[model samples]
Target: MKRFWMAVTLLLTAGVLGACSNLGFNDSSESTASSGTKTATYQTTGTVDSGMYQGVIKNGRYQTSKTRGLATSTNTQSGTYNIKSMENGLLDLAKKQFSTSKYVFQEGQLITEATAENWLGRKSKDNANGLNPASNGKLDEDTRAPIYLQTLLEQDFMTQSGSKLQLGGIAIALGMNEYDYYQKVKYGATYTTHISDAKLVSEGESMAAEIVARLRRLSGVGKNVPILVTLYKNAGSDALVGGTFFRSVLSTSGSDLGKWSTIDQQNETLPTVNNAKPLDSNVSTDFSDFSEQIENFFPTLAGVTAQAHYQDGSLAGLNISINTQFYSETEIMSFTQYVATTAQKYLPDGAKIEITIASTAGTQALITREAGAKGFYTHVFGSY
Candidate 1:
């Protein structure tokens, strides 16, 4: 037993001397306020086909309250894949840059030798007119091409991680997001791809090793303790762009990757209250932007709050409550349509949206039972 302890100590000493610096496990570490956690930033440069991307990964440690004499530490990682280049002609550039067979450019947006045949497959005159290269406004191939690239890169990243790591629970899925500007590809001559705030939570052996090592080095309390990893994007940028949560165990799951669990930050029950006032800061982060947009639409808006309900990490439905002075039936209808369309973009397909409006007189309700493609109001019903 004495010899065994000595050998174990020697091995750990060697490991500390060998890789401590590379792991950034130095003594002088930055703390995350009250939590006894540390933060580390990781960067990787890689090429997808010919297009190069700079991947940024940020990690942080967290510990929730102890339960059954076990305190678990949660570690999170959030990432972004960015591409920049001086390229023109979106479709041509995509074909030259990416390794994909199906680079299908929607008709009426891009013109080619096959444009006539593609146009012939349309269903109606309006559809045909909509595809006219001259009539389609700026919805051309140059702009839409980057969207395809973004989608491809995002999927590849997820697949790569899935194959490499053993994650726990449900893996957090990335959302399809469109920025107001695409740097160069859309409105200008240059082309760039920016995919932001895809999150991965670590649960399993990967997280277990980290906690055990840290505990062994510090005070030796981590044996078999649960660890959480909450990867938050846009931590320093726009609040709305990137704050998806993927809760995974930090320890290894006796496998390559930790088990991951997807969480809807906005999925929660509303606190019971008597007043019909505006919701407080307790509003879920998911609905933060929607609340702000509504307030801006009506400066004198009384109160606004939104809650999202989820099942198995999938958005099941949405509930929004708003209090304002007064608006006509037409105005209310337009507002409901607008909200339904906007929320649908960020929500899963087939998810429902329920909107409740409270005016000075009474209350009204609206429901989009079937939010359409692009979140259009396909089936809307309203009642006072």
Candidate 2:
């Protein structure tokens, strides 16, 4: 098809040039390109040199030679296509006879304005940025352009890092490579990717390797990546984020294709909280941490009978929290222990916490962690 366009464009160029030179055209670069003929007159100024007829811009039309060699142009029509029912099957808007198309951008080597506008899940506008422009992106696993751009968009969408775009939808990736095809779904505005392949080969030279490499780059966003996940959608994709295409790097795993050489990468990313935007949301907004507020609700003035080992009077204290629904002594003791355990995930070495239940008011139970390390972890508990 590209060759066909090239040929057609060449013929058009010949016709245009032939018409221009026949009217006793004797001037060089300074020649006027009147639309009609010698009877018409007009002029404009650019790099006008009477000696420079290098065909770079001769007869007021860009030439297909020199710095721009054999450039071709083919007009593919485009128009705002209202959502016609999909019952007729996916329409091929690239062909004029298929549907009324529109011009996207003829300024470069390729013009997919029609596809950019009306592809399955794309915005009617946005053939700019040289980005995919479509809601979904180009996914040629074998090529770096599509996958890298997809990774960029995915990162932005996950962190809501840049201007956010869209949410869960069924989308397709258009590309020209081995990771050339697949479906991606946008759920919770995060992306989950799945693959449909005849074989999942993790061998060094196989297509699976390229796919894994691309995914690893995308997953570098870590837990900051949003989790717009869905086990199933009508589009048959497991997940999506901001509509960028993502194929599970794990596709190379579970069989001869297992591990995908990403076990180390995936291991690092698995523990990051993607679905919960903890940092993006309000600090006190209760979410997946419901089990940490019991002690604050009841102020219990209780005594502890444990070994308060303070080595050489160092700054050490016990951290406590009540873990009981009734806020009883047993619960207070549990709270004390829980805080100490939770502290391990956030304290400095050798620092300690001493937990004490003060008292229980009407509906409030007070728990305290008498630790010198408390100040160091104030931000963490204060957010609680």
Candidate 3:
């Protein structure tokens, strides 16, 4: 089929050039072209001394050509296309197609209109930047140029090298990729695609790899690199901050024939809180001496207990509880300030320090380490 198309295009080119030449439409000349119904006026705008602007009009379209060596040639088509409209149409078509396809996204339970919209927005942003002129600044993905280029390239390849486009194959490949990305990020399931689906050569390489690579290439924002979706969560809260579903493509080695790497880069961090949790046993031993020193610094204080939280083998935060009797709120606050300043010297680097002072006067003072300061900052209100 590719060979057939190439032959047809070559013959058409030869016929067009012959007809133009016979009609005295050569270098530095102008002529009117007609295709039964559609006609266009094309004018060459270069000197006869140089082979420039060698073009012809047909079917209301103007086209130019340049030939270097016998095997080297180039062609350019001149016409106007509505990029904004084309992108919008393609995005809408893709959304509709995916909504009904096997790759439909299920939100929390089942796919609803709201879920569909969310999925579309997510996938589009993951693939493109999610630009929509129709909506208020943001609507859907702007896919006009890539799709347009793909169409033109498909035609040119068919005309030049007898290669046909695998429209169905491309669609299937992209669908599979999206399905895998969603499954892993949303459902915590992991899988891989084998490279040995088939062994066909296109342009002296594995056609399967070529197709997959191109699909990934088109699924990116710029330079047709690749798109990766990543999700993040933590043990602290049921809320997750990053279901944004976009990341960088690491390497081509992870994406080749017979091998598709797993996407497992989810990260979790302890949420920052005023109250401190239990310290790791190894880190807990260092605080005993410090607690004694804090008690000695304030002989009037009844008792003191310190809890240090560790993150990745380093101190993350510190919370000190002070027990006292008859101390006024101001006196309790002053005690917390003393502890804040004294603890900073002994606490691990980068540890957030908080001091809670409880007194028999039915008043409590909660002081936090001041930002960009070495002293107590402000009171934080919360249950002890």
Candidate 4:
């Protein structure tokens, strides 16, 4: 057990340093604060992707989000996958509009943790600013109003001016629930009320507009800061895959939102379990072939699965998981090598690919190939 953890630590250190170098970022470099003082740039500890920005330090200290830890607080109501997708997906979408070359990322500092909690709760005499509709004294799903808005996430983008960083833009993602699950009485039977697509979109846009206006009124936030708001529809509590953003709006200037644009993104489990039809037949077949090759190579493997992401009917990324029973270092390395080779051969072209090989104990190896890259980076735990 100790050896396994030791291997993981070394792998993580190498991966982080390598990723920083690849992104052309000096994580150790110092930057001048707005107060005319110098401090180390605050580099984030982890990333969803190696290509993601590690974030720029503001002031002398790392400014933690005013609404930190809220994601987990609502993770029960919103599935864990949905929570992750809402945060990471927003960053991916924001990069399209806010280029990484021009802007340095920062956590949302404008919204306080308390304010976020209030807004996510049901409106009442004490909390009138709540985004969720006021609760009437009804228990039935039909009569009771559903909580449309689940959580709000804010991401700040900054532009470097000399050694100091200034707020260049902001991206806010609102996570809306597809179904409102609640217990009629405390610890009693739980009931769910389905929220239609039309209603979710309509309510999301209205909430976004209000959020924009409120943001403009904040002290540090001026009327000119470009704000991008996106609405994410969360998957059901029992869903294996997370939901995707349906609509987005960009306010380049002033408080009023511009036209909303449709985002055609989706998440699907590969191999089409339960006789479900594949969304993309070609990709599914390729994955099936890849799995078959791996299993045939090592018949003792427990199982193989993958989660495929798509944008506009095109493959965007693939995350594959391989469960193995082998623990020997040499065997793991051999399997990893074969998996990487087979992945390049069978996976669709022009999409990011990541694969993890794990045993009953823990992760044994990792392989990744960036989109458009011809080769893969393979790392087997304890191999070194």
Winning model by lDDT: 4
Q: Which tens-of-lDDT digit does each residue in 4-23 have in candidate 4?
A: 00000000000011122122
What TM-score would you give candidate 3 relative to the actual structure? Answer: 0.26
Model 1 off-target regions past 4 Å? 1-267, 270-285, 345-350, 371-384
Query: What is the C-alpha local distance difference test score of each model?
Result: 0.31, 0.23, 0.30, 0.74
Residue 324's lDDT in candidate 3: 74
Rank all candidate structures by their lDDT, best first, as comma-separated numbers.
4, 1, 3, 2
User: TM-score of every model?
Assistant: 0.25, 0.18, 0.26, 0.84
Off-target runs (Cα >4 Å) in candidate 4 are 1-50, 58-61
Q: Which candidate, 3 or 4, would have the higher TM-score against the true structure? A: 4
Model 4 vs. true fold: TM: 0.84
lDDT of 1: 0.31
Which of candidates 2 and 3 is the stronger one according to lDDT?
3
- Sort by TM-score, best first: 4, 3, 1, 2
Better of 1 and 4 by lDDT: 4
Better of 2 and 4 by lDDT: 4
